[model samples]
Target: MNVSRRDEDGPRRVVVGVSGSLGSLAALHRAVAEAGRLGAEVLAVLAWEPPGGEFGYRRSPCPPLLAAVRDAAAGRLATALGEAFGGARPAVPLRSLAVRGQTVPVLVGLAGRPDDLLVVGAGRGLLRRGLRPSVAAGCLRQAGCPVLAVPRPALQHDLDALHRRHFWHLPEEPVPAR
Candidate 1:
């Protein structure tokens, strides 16, 4: 993939998936920091499922309430970005989009172009087993550019300590070489 800087003067384009989760917020923060460092623009995306069904026969059009929720979600994402960037006023260029579809397809389509990076949060256990993997893993496999998966930050110090303790453990070692 195209990992190096495309142009010395131009800003890079970063697309971050925001789902209102803690991990998603972490991803957003990471994207903002990276963008700020690279002088890159950020495309904050929020994907929501359509209100209607596959066919239009019996299903109704999108309701106003649902539309409002989507808008609110997008707004929250923008707010989060602003907070994460320390109220820096969106350095390069910040664009927020609310799409009606699955997150994976939307992000993949967004990342298909060059000079773009995809950033997403490592989801909770349930989400990891389902949509999260589809979006994160699928984007990594399909996106023409590089994908960054930012794991959720650990909250407690004990958890970090435990992680450090297990960090040196080897999976293939035998029990005391017995």
Candidate 2:
């Protein structure tokens, strides 16, 4: 699905990867806000892999299935953009693309231009390194352009909520006052 498009020769773009995760949405928000400030465009790219097997970042061997998957992913990107911006479109031009591939490779590809700014989310689970690296971490390590890895909003985490509740409900110690 396409988001928005402007002249090809426009200024550099702020490229963002959205995977429907809370962290990705946060990164999208940051990208849009930053793009507005810089008078740049937002290139929102969403990547999707098929249900099974490793289909490298090329034309899907099975086009029919891949088409359906791409459709779903694009639809998701649209919904996510709506939610992230809350009807407040960015001041700068915005374009969204849904491509098939792993997040890191697709985003790294998009950031090939020297002026591109890549933004990704940074909420890999604690201890997740053994299992896998986050897309944000991977892109930051490999991409040629500057990368901004925005973690999901702190308030979205359970620990933060628990801390807020605990603080609000704390028992007060009575003190004798003269």
Candidate 3:
């Protein structure tokens, strides 16, 4: 926990990790709200890597492919911000970053100032846990400033259950016309 007041780092900032997931969208909203309350700026960051692992990229080293991948990532970040803010500017000062790297390290590095508040979505299932490390957990451990791990929205769980039911071919009640 950083107890120091804001100084050379400029005004306080709310740095959020955004990945276009429902949980990340929730975290983005929360970060914006927190920034409003704190009179701070909101920095939305989206981290991505090449299609293949870093080692694979190093082996091939195709500049065009890498450029394409980075463009795609920038597009995704724009789409996410559009979804989060509905094409309108946020009330607070807003900035965005689309970087190439691991999510945890990128986020931790950007929110390194003591007055920075690092926000990330907190949600993981058995399958997800097996697949990748949790960004929230990593930020919590590595960030120099305070970390805000926003819980996954209830609707996300409901949607996941719906997806599972659909995948299993389970019959669900039909919806009536509005």
Clash count, one per candidate: 0, 0, 0
Q: Write the per-residue lDDT of candidate 1 for residues 1-178, one digit (tens) a residue.
A: 5554556534577899987666777888788778887778888888776444235413665568566767776787667666666767655578878776678888878766577788988645553476435567767778888899988777533565676678767477666854
- C-alpha-based local distance difference test score of model 3: 0.93
TM-score of each: 0.66, 0.76, 0.90
Scored by TM-score, the top model is 3
lDDT of each: 0.73, 0.83, 0.93
Ranking by lDDT: 3, 2, 1
Candidate scoring better on lDDT of 2 and 3 = 3
Which clashing pairs does model 3 show?
none
Task: Give the distance in Å from residue 150's predicted Cα in candidate 1 to where it truly belongs.
Answer: 0.7
Task: Give the range where candidate 2 is weakest over 10 consecutive residues by summed lDDT.
Answer: 1-10
List runs of model 1 lying over 4 Å from the truth: 1-11, 52-58, 62-66, 82-92, 126-133, 156-178
